[model samples]
Target: MDKKRIILNIVVVCLILFSLYILQNLLMPKYVSAIVEGSLIEEYYNEKADYNHDIIFIGDCEVYESFSPISLWKNYGITSYIRGSAQQLIWQSYYLLEETLKYETPEIVVFNVLAMQYNEPQKEAYNRLTLDGMRMSASKIRAVKASMMEDERLIDYIFPILRYHSRWNELTSEDFKYVFKKDKLFHNGYYMRVDVKPVTSIPRGRKLANYQFGDTAYLYLDKITKLCKDNGIELVLVKVPSIYPVWYDQWEQQIEDYASKNDLLYINFLELIDEVGIDYSKDTYDAGLHMNLTGAEKLSLYLGDVLTKTYDLTDKRTNKEYQEIWQEKIDFYEQMKAQQYYELEKYGYLKSFGAKAPED
Candidate 1:
């Protein structure tokens, strides 16, 4: 080929690659400014590799909102990270666990059973929350396939611009501002809410014709179990103590049976609300749906014992390096807590936690 033709082709290829990169960045949701749950999955990549976590939490909002890694470190000297997002389905959890194994392997993998309720892909928003932050790999490809709805297309996930090109009309200053950067909104993937929304009423679960979990949900749970066993990671299944959702006895039996059959440890926090010291009147932020920072700390304190005794996790807080790292996290945790309390006192609601300020 002629030199001029070769040079032109090279420029064209470079331009195409660069354009796609920018388009992908632009089309992607900027979770930094709002709905920070979407940012939780991607933020785990920023963790320093020097400190190997002893435990890893994976599931949906229940996992993220219920467990506090900072509290775990403070109370049990256990280093941990939570890879959670809103409505993260079982297949998505399996794929996320598959992707996480590529990095550091924790001694135990905690899978919140709330996600098991969803057998099939539930919503595109939830799928994006769990998948958008994942780095491209075979696991991500598999996860996209497993979690996509009937209307979803694989190519749109691969080339996000195709899916999000319509967002051009809704682009705001925050979109362009955080195109390449975002505010760190979570502490080790725990989304904190310090304000209190006391449980006023408990909702009863509607009777299900089939109390059994779907086959697809069981299939993914089996995959998650095998992945953990293969990686030499113990799987701990837990049902966080949320007051309302009304975790039925039938569902409990299924999980208990699965745990017994698999020989895995399963703890239903709902059964231990008194033991965990979770006072819904003071602990939860959104009625009985999710726990606030206080509830998370209480739950973490309870789990710390199980993790240390059952799993034999060594206390890393005594290490000088870990002490220094956790101190910073502690400082941030306190700062957020104080800020939330202050906002609650002043405004009667959390204006600074996950929501953007009105001035912005």
Candidate 2:
């Protein structure tokens, strides 16, 4: 064979290999879906194009686990969605909201403040930044334009691959499926039930001496607060309930002071733990760190009531489209609840096969 013929054959083989790789990705399961699962904000904006809601909750897993959009719909007729990330920091929350506002204008924006205290730089934050950049659309460009820093935004927009390069090896066939199969993506906008055991002592002693807010997070928080105020949106900062041991600390006071100084509505559930009916011994999902499904349900109901009474949040569940969406969410929640019960029973945590109680 001549040189040119050999080159052509090699090119053809390369193309065929690439095609096979793409096909495999499309046919796999979705184990790595959690990574992009948090990217639902981008997906929601991209898919729906034009959307609006009365309330939008943004934060880390606490937001997803604690706030049930379906519960909001069922109780208050509020059409809402949770734009939360796993271990999301303040910077990520700001960008997520910035991206979201491009397609939707929510009347109320609630931020879960648990992760706000986290000052350490995490790889996940960078990964999320890159994903958002990769998923940027015309809407995203406009959102970024309205943002504060051009250089930082450009860093993420241009080099998303660099941020998540470490995740390449972590990707499995399931992750490929999650990316290729649109249906496999979490559309219900809720999280699964997580069981927590009780702890005798709250892990303490580790403290960051000079934990100052990064310019990115601080700037975004100020901008976000102003953006909401300018648009007549109510911005509420809520510290979700965790077990007593984990929740108590000097930092709690610091957070409360910050919220008060800003004139922001800060709801610290720590004081109302008894009022919220949280039995750390039984309500926590993972000892004293977080709440389980049982805990989440109790918190959700409490939040729904608090939001209804505090804000003029209008319920949009009467709309046929919202009603249909909410029904699907309810079904998904039931399935997740059943699975949690099964796990709890299997572990011998419960006697009657009901919800798992937080163990000590």
Candidate 3:
């Protein structure tokens, strides 16, 4: 009788645990449909184990939207991945680099400088978009603690069900369809857009009381630099040719000075616009905030030249195994581009192509 009682108790506990798991999966945002950028961080984990990319990009929308890893591969044979999120902060980038080093140390770590403008946590929504997808680890825990706003809680992250359980009322078929799995959303962490939206007007950056990056921002940057140095990874600082949230002259001087002092390479794409053959008239998707496919390819071509020339990085184009892997990537990249173009031709505007940055 006692053995039977013990077996019954075990069955009951297993049932409860299984139910909790289902509920949690159902309540969490699937990010397979609208607002798809949230899936970017999580998709990194899905990359095949052999993705020992030579370069890794860390920052926000700028890096992901500006450069195409496919373009880099096709042109320069550089294997790279962009670990970016919308409005990703400096500390977030630092912790991502830390986590990435644990998995594989790349030859170069490219960090977008736009995030340096933000000194403190900005919003919970942005925080969730970035952190929610990160697999649990010491780096993720530290990232959450460093990134949480005043009203946010670490427990909420540990058990997303606590925060998202209320979403039961908002659940849809997509929630269930993607609860256990998500549609592959990005190619090598690169978001693709074939449609072109001309840059009509760019609001100028407001004059700031101070142009110097905050202490906390610099502190983490120092950590990032040191971390790379300790791991023998070259850290490259880049400013994408985004016209808004102005990359001020003061800010440029500071980054230039920092790079010079640290012996780091800093590329300000804004200055290389004409050289890169970027036409603001059509190369941008939303005004000058982000690049469309045309602009991204142009920038990638120019940057690829610089990276290969400077680093003397191997051209994996001739490599048999890399050819097999990137051929798959190329096929997927072409498929997505063709799909976006078809969507534009049929609908006259992109309907389900991920996200557009909110007005600043």
Candidate 4:
């Protein structure tokens, strides 16, 4: 009777653990529908085993929406991934870089500079979108500590169900379908938008008493440089040509100065817009804030040339193994592009293709 009771207790514990795992899986955001940026970070884990890319882009929405790895591969044979999110702050980027180094070390790390303007944590929602997907690691723990708003607790990140259990009422069919798995929504972390929203009015940067980046921002920037140097990875700083939230002359000068001082390469795409052949009227999807597929491809082509020539990155287009992988990516890219065009034609705007604003 004692042995039987002990066996029953062991079974009960296993069952309880399994049930909690299922519940945690179900409660977490699927990120299949409205807010898909949340899905980007986790997607990296899925690809980690399959390939070791040559380049890794670390930044915010600008990097994901602006750079097309598919295009880069096709046009220049460069393999890359973007670990990006909405409003990804400086410290968050630093932690993310640290976490990424645990997986594979790439030859180059391209960091977007817009995030430098924000020295502190932003919002809990944005933090979750970026950090929740990161696998449990020392880097993730540091990211959670650095990114959490005052109202958030670290325990909530450790046990996500504690934070998302309230989502029981919000669960949809997607929750059940994607409970254990999710569809890949990005091409090597590039969020594609084929629809075009022409630039009308660009927002001017607000007048600031001090245009200098905060000390905290500089601290992480220095950390990023040092970390890359230690790893023998080239750190290339870039300011994507997002016309809004204006990239000021002061900011440009500061980044330029820092790059010169550190002997690092800094490329501001805003200065190369015309040279890159980006047409503002069609290149941007949500006005000039982010690029559409066309813009990304164009930019990727230009950057691919730079990487190939400057860094001497090999052209792997002829490699059979890489060809096999990229062929699937190419097919998916074309299919997505065609689908977006179809949706645009049918509804006069993209329906499920991450439209900035739904058409009336």
Task: Score every model by TM-score.
Answer: 0.95, 0.72, 0.96, 0.97
Worst 10 residues of 4 by lDDT: 351-360
Give the per-residue lDDT of model 1 (tens digit) for 1-360: 999999999999999999888877887788875787889999999876565588889998899999999999988899999998899898888888888888888899999998778778888988888888888889999999988889999888888888899998898887888888787788999999987779998887899888889999999999999999998999999999886677889999999999999999999999998889989899998887998889999999999888788877888878999898889889988988888889988887777556433342
Candidate number of the best lDDT: 4
Per-residue error for 236 in candidate 1, Å, reads 0.6
In Å, residue 325's CA in model 3 sits off its true spot by 1.3
Give a tens-digit lDDT track for model 3, residues 242-337. Answer: 888788999899999999999999999999989999999889888888899999899989989998888968888998989998899899899888
- In model 1, which runs have C-alpha deviations exceeding 4 angstroms? 355-360
Cα error, candidate 3, residue 161 (Å): 0.5
TM-score of 2: 0.72
Better of 2 and 4 by TM-score: 4
Candidate 4 lDDT tens digits, 1-360: 699999999999999999998999999998988799999999988883466689999999999999999988888889999998888998989999999998889999999999989988888999999999999999999999988888899999999999999999989998999999999899989999888889998777789989999999999999999999999999999888889888889989999999999999888999998999999999998889999989999889888888888896888999999999889989988998899899988887877855655646
lDDT against the true structure, per candidate, is 0.88, 0.63, 0.89, 0.91
Give me the runs in candidate 3 sitting further than 4 Å from their true place.
1-4, 354-360
Global CA lDDT of candidate 1, please?
0.88
**Model 2 per-residue lDDT tens digits across residues 115-214:** 6555444553433432453255653454334332424454544344433455666666656655654542333355545556765666664556645545
